[model samples]
Target: MELVCIECGKARRPENLFPMSCECGGLLEVRHDFRRADAEKLRALFDSRLALRTGPYASGVWRYKELIDPEVEEAHIVTRGEGNTGLYDCAPAARYAGVRKVWLKAQGENPSGSFKDNGMTVAVSRGAAAGFRTLACASTGNTASSLAMYAAWAGLRCLVLVPPGGVADGKLAQTIAYGAEVYGIEGGYDIGVRLLNRYGEELGFYVCNSFNPFRIEGQKSIVIEAAHQLGWSLPDWIVLPGGALSNASALGKGLLEMKAIGLIDRVPRIAVVQAEGASPFHRMIASGGGELVPEPEPRTAASAIRIGNPPSWRKAARVLRECNGVTCAVSDGEIMAAKRVIDRSGIGCEPAAAAGLAGLKMLAEGGTIGRDETALVVLTGHLLKDADAIRMPVPGPALEPLAPDELLARLASVR
Candidate 1:
C-alpha cells in the first residue's frame, strides 16, 4: 500500500510519523494494487467469513481485510467485533421520507456506540504495529470514545482533545471512563482539530483521526458491509450525515473499489446531510463547487456534527464530484422530527444520525431523490450517545391512584 497525496499526486511509503497532509497542505489517501485480486475468490472468502464468530475474521471491517489493509498482520490487528451493525427496513422511515423502499443501517450498534469504531480498529492496529506508544485525536465525542477504547485495549496511552462543553454527556463519560487523558479546547471542535493537525507530531503522539488514510480504509466497510447485507446489490442512493466528511469520502473509495473488483455493477449516488448551523460542506456545494470556506462559528445541537472546519472536506468534495452526490442542510427542528420518526419505528438514533432521514425528506420533496428509488440512511450514533437531546416529560406526581375513575380518564385522553 502507498499513501498518495490527493492534490499533488505525490506518492510515498507509509511511515511511522503522524503528519496526515501532503507538503502542499492537501490530504492523502491510501492506494493498494489489486490488479491480481480475483474478484470471485474475494467474494467467496468474504461470504465464508460470515460464519466465523471469533478473531479478526469476525470483525466486519477485517472480514474484508484484503481490501482494507492486506499488510496488517492478524497479530497486530485490533478489533472489538466492530462493524457488525444491523441494517433495518423501517416502514415508518420509508413512509416519512416519501420513498418506496428505505433501509437504516444502525452503525451506532458498534462497540463504541458509533461508526468511529469501524475506522478506529484499523488505525489503532496500524499505530500499534508501528510501535507507537500513544494514540491521540481531536473529537467531538465518538472518535474520542472509540480511540480511547482501542488504545486502552492495545496497552497504549490514549489522549483526546475535545471542545469544552461541546460533547454530549454520555460520550464524554465514555471517554473518561475508558481512561483517556482528556483535554478541553476553548473554541470547540474546529479549533481543537486545527491544533491537532498542526502540532500532533510535536506532541509526540500518533494521531488517529479521519485524516488518517488507514482510518478511511476501515470506514469503507460501512458501505461494503451494507452491500453484502443487501445480497451484493447496490442501492439507488446512500444518504448519510456529514460531520468531518470522512464517511462520505470513504464511501466513494469503497464503491469505486467494489466496481473495479467486479463486486457490483453500478455505483450508488451519495447524499450528504448537514445541520444548517454547521454546514460548510453544503454551502460549498451550493456555490457551484469551489474551495471550502469554513464556518467561523458552527452552532448546532447535534454535537457530533458541530464542526466548522472539517479536515476531510477536500476528499469528500472529490467523492461528491465522482459519485454525482447531492448535499442539503436541515434545521434542528427537522432533525428532531426525523429522530422522532426513527425512534417511533423502534430504531432509535442520536440527533445527528437522523439528519440523513430529514435530508431524504427534503430531497424527495425537491424531486432530487425519486419517490420510488431505493435509499439507505446510515445512522452514525446510538440514541443513548446523546441522551440529553431527548426531551423528558413534565414533572408530575410520582404515582397516581389506581382508581377506576382515574384509569378511565387516562384511557379517554389516549385516543
Candidate 2:
C-alpha cells in the first residue's frame, strides 16, 4: 500500500503509523493493487465468511480485510461487532422523497451509535500495532465517542478535543463514559484539529480523524457491505449527509474499487447533502468546482455536520465528479421535517442523518433523481445521539383527563 496524494499525485511510503496528508497540503489516499486479487474468488470468500459466527470474518468492516489492509495481523484487530448495520426497505421514506425504491442503510446501529465506528476500529487497531500508546482526535461528537470507545478496547490513552458547547450531550456522555480525556476548545472542530496536528508530534499520539488514510480504508467497507447486502448489485444512487466529506470519498472509492476488481458491474452515483448553514461542499459544486471556500461560522441544528471547512473536500469533489454525482444543501427546517418522516417510520436518526432524506426529496422534485430509480439513503447516527433535537411535542395528539364512561364514549365516537 502507498499513500497517494489526491492532488499533485505525489506517492510516498507512510512514514508514520497514521498518515495524515502530503507535504503539498493535499489529502492522502491509500492505494492498493486490486488487480492481484481474483474478484470472483474474493466475493465467494466474503459470502462464505457470512456463515462464520466469530472472529474478523463476522465484522462487516474486516470481512473484506484483503480489500482494506491485508497486512494487519488478526491479533491486532480490535472489533466491537461493528458494521453489520441493517438495510431496510423504507417505502414510506421513498414516498416522502417521491422515489419508487428507497432503502435506508441504518449505520447508527453500529457500536458507538454512529458510522464513525466503521473507521475507528481500523484506526485504533493499526495504531496499537504500530506501538502508539495514545490515540487522539478532534471531533464534533461521533468521532470522539468512537475513538474513545475503541481506545478503551485497545488499551490506549484517548484524548478528545471538542468545541465548547458544540457537542451534543449524548455524544459527550459517551466519550466521558469511555474514560477519555476531553478538552473543551474555544474554537470549533477545525481549530481543535489544528491544535492536535501542532501537538501530536510532541505528544506522540495518533490522530484518529478522517484525515488519517487508514480510517478511510475502514470506512470504505460501508459501500462494500452495502453492495454485498444488495446481492452484489449496485444501486442507481447513494445519498448521504456530508460532514468532513470522508464518507462520500470512502463510498465512491469503495464502489470504484469493487468495479475495478469485477465484484460489481457498475458504480452508483453518489449524492452528498449538506446543511445549508455549513455547506462548503455544496457551494463549491455550485460555483463550478472552484477552490473550496470555508464557512467560518457554520450554524446548524445538525451539529454532527456543522463543519465549516471539510479537510477531504478535494477528494470528495473528485469522487463526485468521477461518479457523475451532485451535491445539495437543505435548510434546517427541511432537515427537521425529513427527520419527522423518518421517525414516523420507526427508523429514527439524528438531524445530520436526516439530511440525506431531505436532500433526496429535493433532488427527486428537481428531476435530478428519478422517481423510478432505486436509491439508498445512509442514516449515519442513532436517534439518541441527538435526542435534544426531538423534544418537541408530538403532532396531532392531546391528552385530557376524563371519567371512564366519558373515555369509553369518546373511544366509541371515534370512527
By lDDT, the best candidate is 1
| Residue 248's lDDT in candidate 2 | 94
Give lDDT: candidate 2, residue 213.
Answer: 88
Candidate 2 achieves a global lDDT of 0.91
lDDT of 2 by residue, 374-399 (tens): 89999999999999999667444436
| Cα-lDDT of candidate 1 | 0.92
Q: Which stretches of candidate 2 lie over 4 Å from their true place?
A: 394-415
Worst 10 residues of 1 by lDDT: 392-401
The TM-scores of all predictions, comma-separated, are: 0.96, 0.95
Query: Which tens-of-lDDT digit does each residue in 1-415 have in candidate 1?
Result: 8899999998888763457888898888999898888888998999999999999999999999999999888999989999989999889999999999889999999999999999999999999988889898999999999999999888899999998889999999999999999999888777777777788888778889888899999999999999999888977999999999999999899998998888888999999999999999999999986888989889899999999988899988889888999999999999999999998899899999999999999999999999989899999999999999998555556255568888888789888
Which regions of candidate 1 deviate over 4 angstroms? 393-415
Clashing pairs in 1: none
Total backbone collisions for each predicted model = 0, 0
Among all candidates shown, the one with the greatest TM-score: 1
